[model samples]
Structures are given as C-alpha cells and as structure tokens.
Target chain A: EAGVVQSPRYKIIEKKQPVAFWCNPISGHNTLYWYRQNLGQGPELLIRYENEEAVDDSQLPKDRFSAERLKGVDSTLKIQPAELGDSAVYLCASSGGFGETQYFGPGTRLLVL
Target chain B: QQQVKQSPQSLIVQKGGISIINCAYENTAFDYFPWYQQFPGKGPALLIAIRPDVSEKKEGRFTISFNKSAKQFSLHIMDSQPGDSATYFCAASVGGYNKLIFGAGTRLAVHP
Candidate 1:
C-alpha cells in the first residue's frame, strides 16, 4: 500500500510571499492531519480532517494559515505573507479511523527567508 | 502547555547495549502512549505504543514500559545497533487517533 504523499519535498520562499503545500493521504484513510515540525522538536498538529470536515483546528493560525481537505482524500495547507518563523517541515499523515495508527508522508521542508 | 516531558536530550549507546528513553505526562486522561522514530530528513515513523492497562509491551527489539500510577513511560531498545540511531519522540493522546501531545524528543546515537 502506498503511504501518504506530499508534494515539493523542499520549498524556499521570501518573507511576505505566499506558500502552499499539498498532500495526498493513503487509500481508504478516513482521517488526515497536517502538522508543522520545527528544528529539534516534534511535529505539532495544525489541522485535522475527518472525511472532509475539519474536526480539530484549534492550533491552526487562522489569520495567516488556512487548510482545506476537499473530498477527504487530498489536502492543502497555505500560508500567506510568510514569516521567517514559518520556516519548518510540513508533514501530512493519514489514518483509517480516528483512533488508528497514523502513517506519515515524507513532508515538505519550507524555508522562508 | 507542555503535557509530556522527556529526559536525556541526547544519548550515546554502544552496539549490543541497551538504549532507554523516558517520558512523563501530566494528563491522567491520556490513555495511549506511542513512540516515534525519525531520521534526519524523513518524517517520524511509529515505533511502539502502549495503553495504561499494560505495564509492558514488547515488539521484537523494542519494548514500552508503562507505569500508570506514575504517568510515565519508557522505550527500551535491546541489542541496539547503529541503525537505531535516530531522534525518538514520545507522545500521548486521550485516545488512539486523537490529537497527540509530544515530548521534546531524544536523539540517540548508537555507535558500532
């Protein structure tokens, strides 16, 4: 079975520019999650989607960050007017259910200057 | 709020030795504890997990020891090999598949 797939394994953008990352979850996965991982730190949840409905997004910064999981299979995370602090790895994971083990993608490493 | 705390920011172990990483959580409601291993450029992969009901769970060379009373857990790697060198993260969730709160992580370097 194919694991979760993320696009643009690496990305570099200047501060104040817009950046977008895409992800495709595994087949049959009903739940998908987006996470941001900083240097020497564990991945933190940004948003979670349960079959197209965002069930958890409390940790997401709505002012500059937005995510959408249409049709529940693929997802996109966007950051407008990127800040230097936004430079990090954006990881996507998928699970069969809400309580199942999550499979992660290779992740997109974003570098904002 | 840092709910889970992990010790030993870095560890060095010889091949065939034991590598242990410890973590403690403040939320008593957390029932599922899992450990993840990540390489330099790769995303984290699930290593092993345990529930509050079990004291210990072993999978091949990896073992998770959980202490419900203390709200602490540890991962032990037996016969550690150089390939085991990676960053290990401990995380807990109220239930499986829920949002996980993670520890800072431990970087283990197993020397040959």
Candidate 2:
C-alpha cells in the first residue's frame, strides 16, 4: 500500500508571509499527525487527529499555527506570518488506529528568510 | 519528566561491526518505547519497538534491550552495514498512541 503523502517537498518563503502544508494519509488510516522537526533534532508533535476530531493539539502554537483535517483523510497545517524561526521540516504521518505504528511521508522542508 | 535523553550525538562503526544506541527516560509511566531511523531529506521510519513487559526483543539484525528498573533502553544493530547509516531516535509514550517524547537522536555512520 502507498505510504503517507505530503505536498511541496520543499518550500521557501520570506518572513511574515503565510505558508501552508498539505498531507494525505495512507488508505484506511484513521489517525493522522503533524510534526515539526528542527535541524539535529527529532520530530516534535504539533497536532494529532483521530478521524475528524483533534485529540491532541496542546503543543501547537495557536497564535500563528493552525491545522485541520476536514474529511479525516487529508490534513493541512498553516502558519500565518511565518517567522524566521519557523524554518524546519514539517512531517505528516498516519496510522491504522490509535496505538498503531505510524507511517510517515517525505515531509515538506520550509525555509523562511 | 517529559524528556527522553539519548547519548552519543554521533557514532561511527565499521561494516560487520556492532552499532549500539542508548536512551533513558524519567517518566516511569512510559510503557512503550520505539526507535526510528531517518535518512537525509526523508521522514523517520519505525525501526523497532519494545514494551516494558519484555526485557528484550529482536528482529532480524535489530535488537531492543529494555531495562525497566533503570528506565533505559538501547538499540543494537548486529553486523552493521553501510546502509544502516542514518539518524536514529528513541521515543517513549505512556498508554500507547499518546504524546511521544523523543530523544535528541544519534547519527550513526557505518563505514564500509
């Protein structure tokens, strides 16, 4: 089966601009997650969705970051007025269900100048 | 309490040698421990995982040794090959599928 898929493998934007990343989870997967990975570090969870409900988003920066999984199969993470510090890799993953092993996508590398 | 500490930011080993990476956690509530491997420009992929119920779990050339008393775990790669070179991260979660706390990660370079 095909793994999780993300769009715009790489993106570059100027500081203060708005940016968005999209993700498509694996077929039949009901759990999706968005994570940000900084250089020399592991991916940190930003948000998690079980079906269409966001079960975890405590780590997300609500002030500038927002995410949604409208249909529960696809997700989009948005960053408004991106900051220089927002440059990093945004990864999306999906699992068969809660507590299942998650498969990841190639990720979108964002560079904010 | 939420942090998972990993040692040796980087490692180098010769082909056919053994590669070991260690991680420790402070939360005793953590029951599930997993390791992930990532290559350049790619997202992390699950390598191996173990639960507190088991002392050790082995899969092919990968092995996870869990020390429940010490709250530490280690991943061992037997007969390591150059293809095994990548950044490895150790993570733990409580009650499974919960928020996963990951270690800083260790970059392993296996030379041929």
Candidate 3:
C-alpha cells in the first residue's frame, strides 16, 4: 500500500513570509495528524483530525499557525508571517483508527530565515 | 508537564554489542506504547510496539520491555549494526485518542 504523501519536501522562506505544507493521507485512514520536529527533538503534534473535524489543536499557535482537513483526506498546514523559530520538519501521518500504528510521510523541511 | 520522558540524548555502540534506550511515562492512562526510528532527512517509521498487558515483546533483533508498576519501558537492539543508526522515539497514548505523547528521542550511533 502507498504511504502518506506530502508535497514540497523542502521549503525556504524569509521571516514574515507565509508558508504552507500539504499532506495526502493513506486511503481509508480515518485519522490524520500534523507534527513539527525541531532539531534533536521528537515530533510534537500540531493538530489532529478525525475525518474533517479537528479534535485536538490546542497545541497549535493560533496567532500564526492554522490547519484544515478539507475533505477528511487531504490536509494543509499554514504559517502566516512565519518566524525564524518556525524552522522545522513538518511531518504528516495517518492511521486506520485511533490507537493504531501511524504511517508517516516524507515530511516537509521548512527553513525560515 | 511532559508525559513521556526518554533518556540518553545520544548513544554510541559498537557492532555486535547491545544498545538500549529507556523511557518513562507519568500517565497511567497511557495503555499503548510504540517506538519509531527515523533516519536523517526522513520521516519516522514504526519499529515495534507493545501494549501494557505484555511485559515484553520481541521482533527480530528488536525487543520492547515494559514495567507497568514503574511506568517505564525500554528498547533493546541486539547485535547492533551500523545500519541501525538513527533517532529513536518512544511514544504513549490512550486507547481512544490518536494523539501520541512522544519522548525527546535518543540518537543511536552504531559503529562498525
């Protein structure tokens, strides 16, 4: 089976610029997640979606970060007026059900200058 | 507060040696535990996993040891190999929520 897919494997942008990352999860998966991994750190969840509804997004920075799963299959995570601290690898993962193994995507590496 | 805590920010092991990484979790509600391995510039892949009920589970050279009372767990790689060099992350989650609380991660470097 094909794994999760993400676009723009790498991105470089200046501070205050807008950046967006896209993710296409595995077919028939019901759970989709977005995570940010900093250098030397584990993945930190940014948002989680059950179908089209976002169930857990308390960790997302409302001022600059926003995410949406439009059709419950594809997702987009955006950072408006990005900051240098925002530089990290954005990972996307999906699972068939809650508490199941999650398959990850190749992640988009974002470098903010 | 961090729910899951991992030890050994980094480790160096010679081939044929055993490599071990440890993790602890505070929440007793966390019933599922999983380990993921990530190579440089690549996303993490599921290595192995164990539920709280089992004390230990082994797959190939990888083994997961769980201590329910101590709320601690560990990953042991037998016959360490250079190809096993990567960042290992331990995560915990409740049964209903898909959100996983991950540890800081351990970077293992197996030298041949």
Candidate 4:
C-alpha cells in the first residue's frame, strides 16, 4: 500500500505571508497527525485527528496555526501571517487504528525570509 | 515531564562497528517507546520500538535496550554501514500510540 503523501515538498515565503500544507493519509487509516520540525530538532506534534475529530490539538498554536481534516482522509495545515520563526518542516502522518504504528510523509520544507 | 531526553547530539562510527544512541524519559505514564530514522529530505520512518515489559528487543542489526527502572533506553546499530548514517529520534507516548513526545534527536555518521 502507498504511504502517506504530502504536497509541495518545499515552499518559500516572506514573513507575514500565509502558507498552507496538504497531506493525504494511507488508505483505510483512521488516524492522522500533523507535526512541525525545527532545524536540528525532532518533530513536535501540532494536531491529531481521529476520523475527522480532533482528539488532540493542545500543542497547536491557535493564534496563527490551524488544521482541518474534513473527510478524514486528507488534511490541511495553514499558517496565517506566518512569522520568520515559522520556517521549518511540516510533516503529516497516519495510522491504521488506535495505538497503531504511524507512517509519515516526506514533509513540506518552508522557508520564511 | 513529557520530554524525552536523548544524548550524544551527534555520533560518528566506523563501518562494521557499532553505533549507539541513548534516550531517557521522565514521564512514568509513558508506556510505549519508539525509535525513528530519517534521511536527508525524507520523512522519519519507524526503526524499532519496545515497551516497559520487555527489557530488550532486536531486529536484524538493530537492537533496543530498555531500562525501565532507570527510565532510559538505547538503540544499538550492529555492523554499522555508511548507508545507516542518518538522524535518529527516540519518542515516548502514553498507552501505545497517542501524543508522542520526541527527543531532540541524534545525528549518526558511519564512515566507510
């Protein structure tokens, strides 16, 4: 089966601009996750959805970051008026079910100048 | 308490030698521990995992040694090869799979 897929593997934007990243989970997967990885750091959770319901999103920066999984298959993470510090990699992952191993996408590398 | 601390921010090993990366967690509620490997421009992929019940788990050239009492875990790469050079992350989560807390990561370089 194909693994999780993400779009726009790389993106460059200026500070104060809006950016969005897309993700397509594996077939039949029921859980999806969004994470951000800063340079030289591990990926950190931003949001999590279980069949369209966001079960965990406490780590998300509500002031500028938002995510949506309308159909429970694909997801979008958006950053409005992104800051210079927002430059990093955005990753998406999916799992078969609760407590299942998560498979990650290649991720979108964003550079904010 | 949710943080996973990893040591040796960077490691260098010769091919055919062993590579080791260690991690520790403060959250006793975390029952699941997993390791991920990532190459340049690629996403992280699962390498191996273990629970508190098992002290050690091995898969081919990779092994995870868990020290529950010490709240520490280490990944051992046997017969390291140049191809094995990559960034490795250790993570922990409650139950099995939930909100994962990942360590800063260890960049391993295996010179051939």
The best candidate by DockQ is 4
Residue A42 deviation, candidate 1, in Å? Answer: 0.7
Could you tell me the lDDT of residue B66 within candidate 1? 94
DockQ scores of all models, one per candidate: 0.88, 0.84, 0.72, 0.91
lDDT of 3 by residue, A1-113 (tens): 88899989999999999999999999999899999999888899999899999999999999999999997889999999999999999999998977778989999999999
Clashes of each: 1, 0, 0, 0
lDDT at A47 for candidate 1? 94
Per-residue accuracy of model 2 over A1-113 as CA lDDT, tens digit each: 78899999999999999999999999999999999999888889999999999999999999999999998899999999899999999999999998899888999999999
Per-candidate Cα lDDT values, in order, are 0.93, 0.94, 0.93, 0.95
Write the number of the candidate with greater TM-score, choosing between 1 and 3: 1
Which prediction has more favorable lDDT, 2 or 3?
2
Q: Candidate 2 residues B1-112, lDDT tens each?
A: 9999998899999999999999999999998999999999888999999999999999999999999999899999999999999999999998786678889999999999
Model 1 error, position A44 (Å): 0.6
Residue A46 Cα positional deviation in candidate 2, in Å, after optimal superposition: 0.4
Q: What share of the true interface contacts does candidate 4 keep?
A: 0.88
**Candidate 4, pairs of clashing residues:** none
Superposed model 2: Cα runs more than 4 Å off: none
Q: TM-scores across all candidates?
A: 0.98, 0.98, 0.96, 0.98
Candidate ranking under DockQ, highest first, comes to: 4, 1, 2, 3
Worst 10 residues of 2 chain B by lDDT: B94-103
